[model samples]
Target chain A: MEPIMAIVVGLLYAAAIYMMLRRSIVKLVIGLMLLSNAANLLIFTSAGMSRGAPPLIPLGSALPDGPVADPLPQALILTAIVIAFGVLAFAVVLIHRAYNIIRTDNLDQMKDTDT
Target chain B: MSLEVALPVIIPLLTGTFCVMLWRHNVIQRVLSLVGSIALLASSIWLMVSVLREGHVVMYMGNWVAPYGITLVGDMLSAIMVVLTGMMAVAIAIFSLSSASKSHERFGYYPLMHLLLAGVAGSFLTGDIFNLFVWFEVMLIASFALLILGGERAQMEGAVKYVTLNLLSSAIFLSAIGLLYGITGTLNFADISVKLAAAEHTGMVDVIAVMFMISFGIKAAAFPLFFWLPASYHTGPVAVSALFAGLLTKVGVYALFRVFTLIFNQNPDFTHELLLWVAVGTMLTGVLGAAAQFEFRRILSFHIVSQIGYMILGLALFTPLAIIGGVFYIMHHIIVKTNLFLISGITHRLLGTYDLKRLGGMYKARPFLSILFLIPALSLAGIPPLSGFFAKFIIIKAGIEVEAWFVTFVALLVGLLTLYSMIKIWAEVFWKKLPEGIDPTPLKEGKTSGSLAVLYLPVVLLAACTLVIGLHGQPIYEWAEFSASQLLNPEGYIDAVLGGNRP
Candidate 1:
C-alpha cells in the first residue's frame, strides 16, 4: 500500500509539473492544486500507513487503548490542504483579474512588470 | 516560562483581527494599527532585554511539554529578529498611513499588514519547522493581498508570479517537513536535532538538507531561484514593497541559518561547501543584474539578492565569527534595504517616475532627501563609518580568516560594483541636471493627498539606525557575537526546549 501510494504521489507531481509548464495561467492554477495534493499525499504515505483503531481514548483513560493510525500526518496534511485551498482560491481570483485586464491567459504575455 | 516570547506573536495577531473588525472606520484602523505597532515594538524590545538577561526564553503553547507540543523559543537571534520585525512594522505602518490609497485602506490594508507582521513574528519565534511553514503561509497570503491591493494591471501580473512561486516554495517546504518528520517521528526543532544526530540514514539526511535548502533558497532569493523576486517585488505599493524588501527574504535567510547551524551541522563539509558556491553565485548575479537595471526600485530589488549572498557567505564559512557577520549583516541589511526602497518611493513622489533615465537634479532640488538617500546608499556600498561597510567588512574579514581567498575576493569585487551602482543612481537621479524630459518644477509633492513629511519618517529613522549601528558597531557586534555563539551551540536551545526538568 505504501509503495502504491508513493507511485501515485509521483504521478501526481509529474502531472503537476507538466501542467504548470503550460503557458496558460489557468493551467498553472490547476498545476498548483495538483502539486499541493501531491504534497499532502506524500506526507500521508511517507509516514507508514496502517488500518488501525481511531485515535481515541477509551473511557477516561489518558491514552488510546491500542494501535492506531498515526494522527500527526493527517493533522499536518489537513492543515496543508486548508492552506493550499486558500492560496488556490486567491490565485484563481488573481489570474481572473489579470486575464480580464490583459485579455489573455498566456503567462508569457503578462510580462509587463518585468524588465 | 515567561510570556514574553508569546507577546510578539500575540500582539500582532490580536491587533490584526481587531483591525479587520474596524476596517469600516479608516481613522480607527489607522489609530489601532499605530498603537498596535508601538505595542509590538515595545514588547519586542522587552523580549530582547529579557533574552539578554536570561539566555534562551522558551514558552510552550497551551502549556504543552517540549517535544510533545509546540514551543516558542527566543534566543539572541530570534529576539533580535522580532525586534527588527517590530521596528519595520512601525515604520511600514506609519508609512502606509500616508501612502496607502483610500481604496486600499478600505480593503483592509492595515489588517493585512498586521497579519503579515504576526506571521513574521511567528516564523521567528516558532521552535518547530511545521509551525514555521504555517507562519510562512500566513505571511505569504497577507503579502499576496497587499501586493495586489490596488488591483492595477501591472500589480496583478507581478502578484501572479509572486503567489505562484511563493506557494511553490511553501509546498516544497511542507514536503520537506513531512520527510523530516517521517525520518525522525518528531516535529520539534530540538527533538529533531537530537534525533538526527543519531539517525543512521546519512544519505537521506543529505537529501533532506538539500530539500530544505531549495525550499528556503527560493524565499531567500538566492541565485538561480530568485527570478520570482525581481519579477514581483517592485510592483507593489511603496509601503508594501518596502516591508517585503525589509523582512521577507531575511526570514528565509534566518531559516537557512537556523536549520543548517542547528540540525544539519553534522555534515558541514558537504552542506557548507555547497552554500559557499551558492553565496558566490547569488552575489555575482544579483549585483550584475542590478548593474543592468535602469529602474530605481528594480535595481534595489536585485541588490536585495546580492546582499543576501553576503549573509549566506557568512553562513557558508560556518565559523563563529562568520555567523556573527551573517547575523550582523541581517540587522544592517534590513534597515538599509528598506530605507533605500522608501527613498525610491520619495523619488517617485517628487520626480513622477521610477525610471533612472528620466530622473535628475535631486541634489540641488531637495538636499535633505538626497542626504537621506545617500546615507543608506553609501552604507549599502560599504562606505566607512556606515552600516554597510561594517557588515561587508565583517563578512569579508571572516572569509579572509577562513583563507577563502576566492570568495573574499568576490565579496570585495561585489562591494566595488555595488558602489558603482550607487553612484549610478546618484549621478542619474541627483547629480546630473534634471533630465530634459522630466518636469523642471517638482510636481505637487505627495502623490497621495497625505503629507510627504509622513513618508520621510521611516526613511529618516532607518537611516539614523544605520548610522547608530555603524558608529556603535561594538555593541551590535557583541550582540551578534552572542547570537552567533547561541546558534553555533544549540545546547541551550535544545535544553530549553526538551530538558523536561525545567521549572
Candidate 2:
C-alpha cells in the first residue's frame, strides 16, 4: 500500500515538474497546483499506512487503549492544504491580473522587472 | 507567568484586527497602529529582560505540558529578534502615516503590515517546527498582497516572480516538515533534539537536514537563491521594502542558525561545511551584484544579500565568539539596513528620483540629509565608531583566531567591496551636482511641513540608534555573547521546553 502511494506521488511530481517548464504562465500555475498536491500526497504516504481506529478515548479514560492512527499528519495536511488553497487562489488572480495588464500569458514576456 | 511569552504576538494580532474594524476611520486606524507598535516594543523588551535575568520563558498552550502541546518559548535569541521586530514595527508605523498614499491607507496596508509583524513575532517565538511553517505562510501572503497592492505594471511583474518563488519555497518547506515529522514523530524542536541525539543517526537524518537547509536558504536569500529579492524589492514602496529588508530574510537566517545549532548539530561535519561554502558564495555574489547596480534601492537590495553572508559566516565558524559576532551582526544589520531604506525613501520624496545617475547635490542642498545618509552608509561599509565596524571587526577577529585564512581573506575583501559600493552611492547621490532637468520640487511640495517632519522622524531615530550601538557597544556585545552561549549549549532550552516549568 505504501509503495503504491509512493509511486502515485512520484508520478504527480513528475507531471508537476513537466507542467512547470512550459512558457505559458497559466500552465505554470497549473504546475504549481500539481506540485502542491504532490507534496500533500507525499506527506500522507510518508506518515505510513495504518488501519487503526479513530483516535478517541473512553468517557472516563485518560487515554485510548487501542491502536490509533496518528492524528498529527492529518492536522498537518489540513493546514498545508488550506494554506496552499489560499495562496493558489491568490496566484490565479495575480496571473489573471498580470495577463490583463501585460497583454500576454507567456512567462518570457514578464521579464520587464528583471532589468 | 507565560503571558510574557505571548504578549509580543498578541498585541500585533489584536491591533491588526482592530485596525480592520476601524476601516472607515483612517485617522483612528493610524493611531491604533502606532499604539499597537509601541505596545509590542514594550512587551518585547519586557520579555528580553526577564529572559536575561531568569532563564528561558516557555508557555504551553491550553494548559498542556511540554512535547504534547503547542509551546511558545523565548530564549535570548528569540527575545532579541522580537525586540528588533518591535522596533521596526514602530518605525514603519510612524513612517507609514505620511508615506502611504490615501488609497494605500484606505485599502488594508496597516492591517497587512501588522499581520506581517504578527507572523514574524510568532516565528521567532514558536517551539514547534510546523508552527514555523504556518507563520511563514502568514508572512508570505501578507507580503504578496503588499508587493502588488498598487497594481503598477512593474509591481505586478515583480509580484509574479516574488509570489511564485516564495510559494515554491513554502511547498518545499512543508514537504520537509512532513518528512521530519514522519521520522521524529514529534514537531517540538527541543524534543526532536533529544530524540535524535539519543537515537543513532541514519543517512535519512542527513537527507532531511539538507532539505531544511535548502528551503531556509531560499528564504534567507543565500547564494544562487536570491534572484527574486532584487527583482521585486525595489518595485514596492520604500517603507514596505524597508520592512522586508529588515525582517523577512533575517527570519530565514534566524531559522538556519536555530536549526543548525540545535536539531542539526550532530552532522556539522556535513552541514556546516556546506554552509561555509554557501556563506562565501553569498558574500562574493551579493557584493558583485551590488557593484553592478546603479539604482538606489536595487543597490541596497543586493547589499542586503551580501550582509547576510557575514551573519552566516559567523554561524558556520561554529565558535562561541563567532556565534556572538553572528548574533551581533544580525542585530546591527537589521537596524542599519532598515534605516538605509528609510533614508532612501526620503531621498526619493525630496529629489524625485532613485536613479543614482540623476541624483546629486544633496551635500550642497541638503547637508542634514547627507549626514543622515553618511551614518548608515559608512557604517554599512564597516567604518569605525559605527555599528558595522564593530560587527565586521568581531567576525573577522574570530575568523583569524580560528586560522581560517581564506575565509578571513574573503571577509576582508568583501568589506572593501562593500565600502566601494557605499561610497558609490555617496558619490553619485550626494556629492555629484544635481543632474540637469531633475525635479527640484519635493512631492506635494506645498503640503504641510508637519508631514515632512514625520518623514524625517523615523530616520533620525534609527540613525541615533546606529550611533548608540557604535559608541556604546559593550553591553550590546555582551548581550550577544550571552545569547551565543545559549545557542551553542541548548541544555537549558531543552529542559525548559520539554520538562522544567517557566519562572
Q: Return the number of clashes found in candidate 1.
A: 0
User: Which 10-residue window of candidate 2 chain B scores lowest in summed lDDT?
Assistant: B439-448
List, for all models, the DockQ compared with the true complex: 0.78, 0.78
TM-score of each: 0.98, 0.98
Per-residue CA lDDT of candidate 1, range B196-222, in tens? Answer: 987885698999899899999999999
Candidate 2 lDDT tens digits, A14-71: 9988888899998989989988998898888788668757888989999998788888
Candidate 1: how large is its RMSD? 1.8
In the range B79-123, model 2's lDDT, one tens digit per residue, is 999999999999999999889887888889889999999999999
Backbone clash tally (model 2): 0
Reference-based lDDT, each prediction: 0.91, 0.90
Native contact recovery (fnat) for each candidate is 0.67, 0.65
In lDDT terms, which candidate is top? 1
Off by over 4 Å in 1: B443-450, B501-503
